[model samples]
Target: MNTVTRPRILVVGAGFAGVECVRRLERKLSPDEADVTLVTPFAYQLYLPLLPQVASGVLTPQSIAVSLRRSKKYRTRIIPGGAIGVDLKSKVCVIRTITDQIVNEPYDYIVLAPGSITRTFDIPGLTDHAFGMKTLAEAAYIRDHVISQLDLADASQDPVERASRLQFVVVGGGYAGTETAACLQRLTHAAVKRYPRLDPGLIKWHLIDIAPKLMPELGEKLGSSAQEILRRRGIEISLGVSIAKAGPEEVTFTDGRVIPTRTLIWTAGVVASPLIATLGAETVKGRLAVAPEMNLPGNDGVFALGDSAAVPDLAKGDGAMCPPTAQHALRQGRHVADNVIASLRGGPMRPYVHKDLGLVVDLGGTDAVSKPLGIELRGVPAQAVARGYHWSALRTNVAKTRVMTNWLLNAVAGDDFVRTGFQARKAARLKDFEYTDAYLTPEQVRAHVEGTARQE
Candidate 1:
């Protein structure tokens, strides 16, 4: 082993931003310059954009999850755990490893790309009921739960229980909610063919949002087109309505309507990870406020980006911050890497600038809408653009091949509609996946680091 010491660089989270940063750092930085260490709960950088397809059985979970250890020359030290807290003054990160052991990691330079978690309101019984689509496991679990619901409903004799099992409700009108509702609806639509007893008519899907327009960012014409398509497919598209309360077997809407449903998918939106709050830094709407260069003001060695950082959108101007999208996060990662390297070499840093690439919504099968380069498209043309974008975005040849093969197989042979007993529960809430409550307070972080120091 080389005896010469180098500056220790630590990166948290393996999402788009963190992964891209690490990859760029590895390629750009020589071994003598800096040592990069990545902290994450998973070994793979999940392609989160295709999560809905995984939930709907269009693509296998492994297809989107690209492994980080793809090269034998990989030198970055990997910590398979989550950073519960960060002490900026001490330059140490408190981590909870996969085995539930707590440890302290000191760094010369640290990147905070912990990303976002599901945004849940104080609505009654939300924690007891509602499912999420933020993680791979959540997506897989949802697939199993939906399949199980169909099985249970088909095997039931009681009309009430069967009816309740057949109804599904999805909350949120953004890309996640719309795509999830659309993909899962198609899953059930194709699945009912396997069930002889369950009438396809009995299966109902309700996609509602508190926002007046569905996918408002897509502009009025495309938004209306998407709504019309969903409505024509027997899905009840309700705007300006939301869940008043969620229960084990029902969801009460804000409009005084009570619908019985065993499945409640809450994709309302996401908030910055509570991990960012451990720094006790200034934040804008729960996201860490960073300068245009994606660094904390006054904290020279620390940087934040992705969903957790409120990066100023210099390209958009007028005091607008970049939206928490994969597009922005991926680009920010590369830019932040350049900035970090610049800081290390005493070079000047440049602000992040990205041109709008537009949006794509794959509403299952040939029905879709997209705005690439400000030009609107619909039907097969839009679907082509959507899939093509996702396919091109895959990080590895193996991942791309797996995804393409899975897509082809799914298109030709179709899904078996099977459920893995991975999640052995009737209902799982958002709390089960993301450990938001597990984040340590600032005082605790200081104590933990000090305690670890004394022990060392």
Candidate 2:
């Protein structure tokens, strides 16, 4: 009898990196050589850059998500699960299914692409009071929340309560934070036209951060320009400040300035998933440390990429790791696939090297700032380039068309800030979605195994 031999490649997470990695793997490996399986909680690749557009009602939720099952170029299995733990020694990954069932899958080669999660601060009431801008549900909820607040404010008899409802505070001034503020502010501006009684000035939008300027990574010139545009639009830019405390109807900032508001959108920052900590590997600054080839040191069959991995930057001098950005993640994923193929076929692996290709900040209302290849551009031209870059960066034509269509519609029909009121009362805070150590530790796993061993 002839023995059947094939390498099993298991890729965790369906984010930008994992999806692209799987795509390249399917292209490089023949069906007879390997069986590729992509494990993720969702079956869609989320276009995170356009998430603010979804929240602002400029685009539908489905517009920002590309279906994984629709890819016909590659023959790959999509396993729906969030990888919680991995035994590198045993080559077994423990994944938690959506139904809360645990399954152990053995693989010849493992790719760790489990993406990052929102980083929260120790500020009191931030966990309970603030809304996060990470996922589609959160973005959609924010849309409803913002519109509903305006609707309630317009109808309220109490002036203080109405004022509180009208004021919206956004924490953090990073790309996500800035975009969310700009998009949501434009949304509120258009939405208030429906309510004649409400004063446009009364509908306040505050963007606060501990940093000295907005979008500091965009550098001084572009960052200043973006901040100025936002300020001109009546969106208050509070630099070197943070929300000291948050209450149900009011927020106190570090500057001792108190603002009465019902909405607090948190886009502070993101840290590597707790899943990375479970890998039992050396990590640098919360990311799994990997060589320039995107392979785990001391492990031949393991690799990692994207926000979860701290890949060494060969382009930069000694001791520099690639930043957790989509540009690097996408490139890393493709390179990882190439290296993996090389490993399987007895070839050399190339190190990842790419120059920083500037940053772009879309400030809504035909205002944007971009520094592509060190050439800074601002205003409508910058907006054009920022959007064009995003459109070109998308993996598929369908996504590009959909995004362009949304943009065209926005330009023609303006924004529709209608509230769907989904997840109105449910707690959708960052802490609520956080995967705590209490449930992820070995003790919990042991208890779970002990209880479910017989059941299994």
Question: How big is the positional error of residue 74 in model 2, measured in Å on the Cα after superposition?
Answer: 2.9
Tens-place lDDT digits, model 2, residues 25-66: 988787888889999888999988888989998888888798
- After TM-score superposition, what is the CA distance of residue 269 in candidate 2 from its true location, in Å? 0.9
Candidate 1 lDDT score at position 396: 88
238-311 per-residue lDDT for model 1 (tens digits): 89999999988899999999999999999999999999889989999999999999999988699999999999
lDDT of 2 at 7: 85
Q: Which segments of model 2 are wrong by more than 4 Å? A: 1-4, 423-427, 434-439, 442-456
| Cα-based TM-score, every candidate | 0.98, 0.95
Displacement of residue 216 (Cα, Å) in model 2 is 1.7
Query: What value of lDDT does candidate 2 attain over all alpha carbons?
Result: 0.86
lDDT of 1 at 108: 89
